[model samples]
Target: MSTSRHPLRGDVLGEQPEAMAAFWRLYGLLWSHGTVDQSIKEIARLRNARTTDCAYCRNVRFAGARDDGLTEDRVALIEDGYETSTLTEREKAVIRYVDTFLHDPAGLTDTQRAELLEHFTPGQLVELTAGVALFLGFSKIAVALGPPPGMPTLVVPTPDWAPGEAQP
Candidate 1:
């Protein structure tokens, strides 16, 4: 493990404090009050972490998602061949959606579009799409910033702050 810290680990933020604060503010809203189930989003999040190989993102868990029934077994199944795993169809769809969204949005076929529509409302679709984008961008940033001292398996509260409040 590296002993250095990323500037965006909720403190330095590359010396752009207000921008980072705004980012956290939006992130807090996305997690605390999004329409989709927190567990569903968490699954996609973990999947993104694995895809991006972001150590920090992989290590941090969301308590609300866990409470909503995202168990360790389910978490373990969000890997390379998750389609054959025991995860629900909806869960598998979200992972596929994330993978496509991350790898090639233009490649999303009609069948894939219909699969998403089968399981999610338009609003939920928007949220999930935005969520994947956010997770992907941040995960890439965290990875590009380089290793940030050893991180623990932190279970962050979904409600650690108010819906619109930035992390404290």
Candidate 2:
């Protein structure tokens, strides 16, 4: 609507081309793999954004959740009372993993790992972990660096890609 890209978006492309290129390559590889559902990935990403308090992540990812078919009600409940909410057991499990992954990764107990293994393969677990790491890393940068000067803090930008659409 504003026709103004987040300053961080342009800064990444302009000041650090190599880093941006690497990020896109990694993002393309994982996002298109289809080893995990787009909905699940969106939820996990939103969870990470919330945990990290990255406005940039939310600005970008909120559109993704919608495209992935998550209803407004569902997104609202993600941080409020997810355990008691209507999200599926699989989603709840992913949320649980993200909690542990963000808070105390080394403290993840055997029971937790076993529970995730019950629903997802070892490979899926790895992919999910990778996704978490990517979001966490990028979120840190976004929240820390923030937008460049003279830019408004919040922007309701469109997602770079559509849900379930694979990109190169």
| Model 2 regions lying over 4 Å from their true place | 1-10, 62-65, 148-168
User: Ten consecutive residues with minimal summed lDDT in candidate 1?
Assistant: 5-14
- lDDT at position 106, candidate 1: 93
TM per candidate comes to 0.87, 0.77
Clashes of 2: 0
**TM-score for predicted model 2 compared with the true structure:** 0.77
Clashes of each: 1, 0
Deviation in angstroms for 151 in model 2? 10
Q: How displaced is residue 103 in candidate 2, in Å?
A: 0.8
lDDT of 2 by residue, 1-168 (tens): 355465445465447666666666677667655587767887888899889877767645434446667776777778858999989988999999998899999988888888899989998888999989988988898777663444332423233444554332
lDDT of each: 0.84, 0.74
Residue-by-residue lDDT tens digits, candidate 1, 49-83: 98888999999889999999997777888988887
- RMSD for all candidates, in order, please: 3.2, 6.3
